[model samples]
Target: MIRPRHILRVFLLTTLLTTCLTGLSACGFVGFPGVYKIDIEQGNLVTQEMIEQLQPGMSRRQVRFIMGSPLVEDTFQPDRWDYPYVIRNGPDIIREAQVRIFFEGDSLVDVTGDYLPSWANPNAEPQGSTESEETEEAKES
Candidate 1:
């Protein structure tokens, strides 16, 4: 008692349902609420701790040894180096920092951007404890 017309109707209905389901998923609606994507991190991981280690009068090799190679070193401005870091989760940026190091001749002279150097503190003594022994002995007194 199977009719050809009834079989044709069922096939058309199934095809339509399949098409609708495919469209919904293609539009990002099927698994919309609970999906997760890993955060993406790019460029140098310049940190405050690293910046604190920086000292003026340090040579280029010393800076590179401490902070790693700069992410952006301008061709025309050979003495300037830029460190940039960023983290993104999908379309949202979670964190970012930029630090610029400037050199006079071969020595690091100035640093500007996200973090401050340790020597910026008034109480902080110059690095390497280059002060005279008498000054240190006097301070102990």
Candidate 2:
């Protein structure tokens, strides 16, 4: 002999339990602990060593051989090629790099963006020469 009041109370408790469980399950979708995220890599991978191989007068074919195919080539600007790379962990970008190469006719003319040839990098230390040695040589000259 179940009373009407007892049935109503049981129904309310069940509804409340279900609601709480549903709410807790949604927390995982919002980046809760223990959630796994895979790193995503996109576009061409260009390295400083590859950039150093480039020379100002190299042909487009040589440039492509050293740097690989560019990620973007503008239709409106046929002489420009863009290489862009990115790594992401979920929605957060961990790393990004870009390089733009310009050609004049068949010859490579200019390069810009995240990397440059070692000869073109002003911040790069001169190979096999220390600053002190260079200063001493300058003083002698």
Can you write out model 1's per-residue Cα lDDT over 22-68, one digit (the tens) per residue? 99888674446667968999888887888888889999999999889
Weakest lDDT window of 10 consecutive positions for candidate 2: 27-36
Per-residue lDDT for 54 in model 2? 96
In candidate 1, position 45 carries an lDDT of 89
C-alpha RMSD of each candidate structure in angstroms: 7.5, 5.8
Q: After superposition, how far is residue 52 of candidate 1 from its true place, in Å?
A: 1.4
lDDT of each: 0.87, 0.91
For candidate 2, what is the total of clashing residue pairs? 0
Error (Å) of candidate 1 at residue 58 is: 0.5
Question: Can you give the lDDT of residue 107 in candidate 2?
Answer: 92
- TM-scores of all candidate predictions against the true structure: 0.63, 0.69
